[model samples]
Target: MEVDTLRLGFIGFGEAASRFAQDLSQAGLRHIVAYSPSAAKAVLDDAIRKKADDAGVELLKTPKAVCERAQLIVALPPGSKALAVLRRVRPHLRPHHVYIDASTSSVKDMEQAAHMLDGVAPFVDAAVMDPVPINGIKVLTVASGSHAEQFRAALEPYGMNIQVVGEKPGAASAMKLLRSVCMKGLAALLFESLEAAQRYGIADVLAADMARFINGRPFEQIMKRFVCGTAIHSERRIHEVSESLALLKSLGASTRMTRAIRETLQQITDMGLREHFGAREPETIAPVLDAIIDAKRAQRT
Candidate 1:
């Protein structure tokens, strides 16, 4: 598809859509239209309208109008509103239209959104993999569903970084959630520790020490060592976390994450991890994870 000739439509013109439309327009795709219900007042101070104007995107009154005008439509509403927006435009969607649902929605929601367009249009479940504020339209994104490649090919010409992960509707969303589990957990852990350390006026020093420890080796190697080491030394770690949690409470800092950590360490200790290892540390993380899984399965049974 020629960049200049493609008519792009956005169902919501929020920050992500505005940044994307602006960059796409700059990249030579001139015909961009959008419809945001909240911005329908058409007042000069309307934020979405201002964004659309800055991006050279024509603002339509309804999503149906956007569907009628463009062959490639992007659904950029909030995750909760994504399906509602899609439901409204679904009836207007045509066989030639390519619908991209680029929202941070649940896997089930993505699947439902794709199903809504089953015979009407090609559906692309695209997960924005990076901060759009920093990367703009070229933000890293992973796309899935049967029509993912088509969406990627159509927009790659406009500097959009889209990787097609699989042919399943929720594959990209699953990847996003998997990543979030680690990223969000690590962030919460850091926040808990830092807040406690700040009370002792050692937050900066602790952060520096943590940086050195984390950067000393390849993360994969460190990850294996930590997981395997935790299994073998679960009892000692439980004691250490107990002391830390008490200190955090004294400092008036939040103890939620630390308390959870202590409970998890106690669970591992109670699972006979030390006895399973028999004073020997596991060489890999798999054995420790498998033991935990087995324990959980046994409890369920």
Candidate 2:
């Protein structure tokens, strides 16, 4: 699978797409094109251009142009806008072209997109397993569809660690959705417990016990930080938990924990903490939370 000769296109040149383009370019995989919505296109174009210039890649104007320029298309648009992008690009998709959807969309949406792309191109639903910010270009991905192998080959050149989950179009999405339930659910739980513990002056003890229970696991530590961070970024955390709930429903599983997570997030939102927490680094959140808790306790006393 010689990826150098194959042109790669990106729909939605946002954070993820920019990272993908930059990483692929650094890996010496050229022939990249990208498109975003009309309003955001210019902004994204400039950012992507800087990235492309540094990595030596190309930036396209329209989604259709991207499709025309690349045999392998990676759709990194938001989950809500994924179907719209597909519909817009469907007319330009050609036979033998492969569409890899790396967005966090619903299983039904992925299946629908796959059906819409049938014959015109092979559609593979790819679930990105880690945050691209930390993983860079070598992100772990699980893809499923009739053309999984071909999609994997195309992405491999970009240093993708891809696994073919199954032949069903939505199988990979199902796995990602289910995994989000556990990953984000844990985050939500930690947030709620730590917030309550802080108010009651038990936060330090709770953190110590948590460390012992999890045997000081790196992910556990990360979750602790995520919890404190969510006190400020509750909105985004809420959205992820909402998506995780949808994923649970799609899998015929109960949404008990997810429902609880939403409630916890709402509590944080009601407190107007999203603005304060959203942009703050995880490392800087604990002291801010501790101060707020102390003030609240003093008022009550």
Candidate 3:
């Protein structure tokens, strides 16, 4: 079948799904259908409804409508909801169809999801490797499955950078998680290290010290600037991180590292260094940190 003729459908019409639909549209795939489990959101949220309409995405109400309209269905629900999303679409799946899971699933979890689809339809595990907003649909992705090549063939024509890692079901997911560990660990370390430098009133020296380390990470450019600027807006960062912790708590998701970093930022904020640079960012980290020291000494007196 021609790529142009294929009907692209998304199971979750959230941010990722909308971006992919628009990207595919740009690549000459004119027909796109999307459905959300919260289909009622269209009535409640004008922005969401308008987004679907703007992307040329035909928003349907049921998984059955989504499954029936398109031969390929991309499941973009949250990792935790992957099984439920699949179950909802399961009754409508045919052997001729393909279900590509591009959710945040663990290796074992992805394997279970694939096993759950046994004999129903071909299931491909897709590991999203970069932020979709910045990279667009060309965002690097690793896909693994019995139908890996088939998945690549259909999508690569549409600006997707899909490579087959292995056919072992969860191989792509493993690689993605390994990459996440390194990148997120660097973010965590960057924040903590800067907080240490701030404490000693030597943050400027540490910025130069960290230049050597930042050049080696995956997202070095972005991470370096973020590391250097986090303290200038420490109060905002603390509040944002706190809200993130609250969000994860509400979701019943694991927040061990999130809580750790949140508390770390909280310490800096409470130390009176928050927005210490005022409306402008200082060239050296020492200016703001010196303010922190002055404030702390004043408190002691």
Candidate 2 structure quality by residue, lDDT tens digits, 1-301: 3566878888877777788788888787878887777423556546546766675656677777787788889998899888988999899998868898989889999999999988888899988888898887777889999889988887786687899999999999899999998878778767655665665578899989987977756765766766777776777788888876776566555566568779978876666655554555456556657745765576579
Candidate lDDT (C-alpha), each: 0.89, 0.78, 0.80
Model 2: worst 10 consecutive residues (lDDT sum)? 38-47
Write the residue-wise lDDT of candidate 1 on 95-197 in tens digits: 9899998989999999998888888899999899888999897788899998899888889988999999999999998999999998999999999999889
**Shift of residue 25 alpha carbon in model 2, Å:** 1.0
Quote the lDDT for 129 in model 2: 81
Sort the candidates on TM-score, descending order: 1, 3, 2
lDDT of 1: 0.89
Q: What is the lDDT of residue 49 in candidate 1?
A: 72
Model 3 agreement with the true structure over 1-301: per-residue lDDT tens digits: 4676787789998878888888888777777898986654468457877887778888888889988899888888888998888888999999988999999888998899899889999999998888788877889889999988888888899888999999888998899998888778977766655554565577788888778665666665555456446665666787788776676566555567777777767766676554555646656655656776787788799
Model 3: CA > 4 A from native: 40-45, 213-301
Give the range where candidate 3 is weakest over 10 consecutive residues by summed lDDT: 219-228
Q: Find the candidate with the highest lDDT and give its number.
A: 1
